[model samples]
Target: MITDLIAGLFMIAGTFLMFLAGLGLLRMPDLLMRMHATTKAGAMGIGLVMIGVALHFLEAGVTARVLIIVLFVMLTAPVAAHTIGRAGYFVGVPLWEGMLKDELKGRYDAETHTLASPPEHQNKEP
Candidate 1:
């Protein structure tokens, strides 16, 4: 049936994303880059896989559960990644040598563990 083909395509795409996430984890030089890749790709892959499952099942209960799971993951993954990255930075994790600009360089206060807002002058648009 057409539904089955669509489901298969979704699952394959999801699996490919998951594989790319793993590859990124292994290949990325620094913690933040790896986290960015894994979190974005992994969350999307799971969402797609769950959507495919929901479509294939064609049952209300199964679809509802899948939707809940995907929504929860999509909401939480980025937040969790951010928390982890922030913690790592605070703990003295070194960034990659080739990194160009550190936007947080002067804004983050190591003593207070807080980020100060940019000056009002800089906030104004050109």
Candidate 2:
């Protein structure tokens, strides 16, 4: 059936993303980059896998559970990554040597332990 085909494709795609995420985590040079790999690709991979599960089940209870799992992963992954990265930065975790610009270089006050946006970012209104 069409649903099975779609679900299979999603599962395959999710597996591929997870594989790439693993490779990236191993190959990336810095903590931030590795976190990027794990959070972004891993989250997407898991979300897709959940979507495939939901599609394959096609039951109200199973679909709802899968959807909730996906939503929680999607919501938390980025925030978790950001929080970890910020903590690492605040603690002076060295960035990769190849890194060009540090946008947060002067944006943070070490003594105050507070972060402020860049001038441009501050001026912009949401």
Candidate 3:
């Protein structure tokens, strides 16, 4: 009974997170921001849903499979988002106007298609 209640809660939480993620994707103005929404919230939502399923099953095989699904989603989502963001950045996608700083500015060389981290001294804020 307790397990069922807990599973239901987790399922609800997952649904809410996924809904928020969809809202974020629609509301955010930039590619990076949308990516952030989908990656973080979507991954978490899927993970929670999988956890709920595993809990409901309470079987070794099903639990293991669901756990693997959760792990895979958590691991891949961030990497996929980062890769897409980097591609967008390299292709000259503009950041949102309200952005405070551009840490990557001057670090990428269009001519050579190369990127490098700024020097230690340049990393500090005034």
TM-score sort, best first: 1, 3, 2
Candidate 3 lDDT, 1-126, residue by residue in tens: 999999999999999999999999999989999999989899999989888998898999999999899989988899999999999999999899998888889889999999887798877999
Worst 10 residues of 1 by lDDT: 101-110
TM-score of each: 0.93, 0.86, 0.92
Instruction: Pick out the ten consecutive residues of candidate 2 with the lowest summed lDDT.
Output: 115-124
> Which is the winner by TM-score between candidate 1 and candidate 2?
1
Point out where model 2 deviates above 4 Å.
116-126
Question: Candidates' lDDT values, in order?
Answer: 0.93, 0.93, 0.93
Which sections of candidate 1 miss by over 4 Å?
none
**Model 3 lowest lDDT segment of ten:** 114-123
| Model 3 regions lying over 4 Å from their true place | 123-126
Which of candidates 2 and 3 reaches a greater TM-score? 3
Model 1, span 1-126: residue lDDT tens: 899889889999999999999999999999999999999999999988998898899999999999999999999999999999999988889999999988788788888888998889978999
Clashes of each: 0, 0, 0
- On TM-score, the candidate that comes out on top is 1
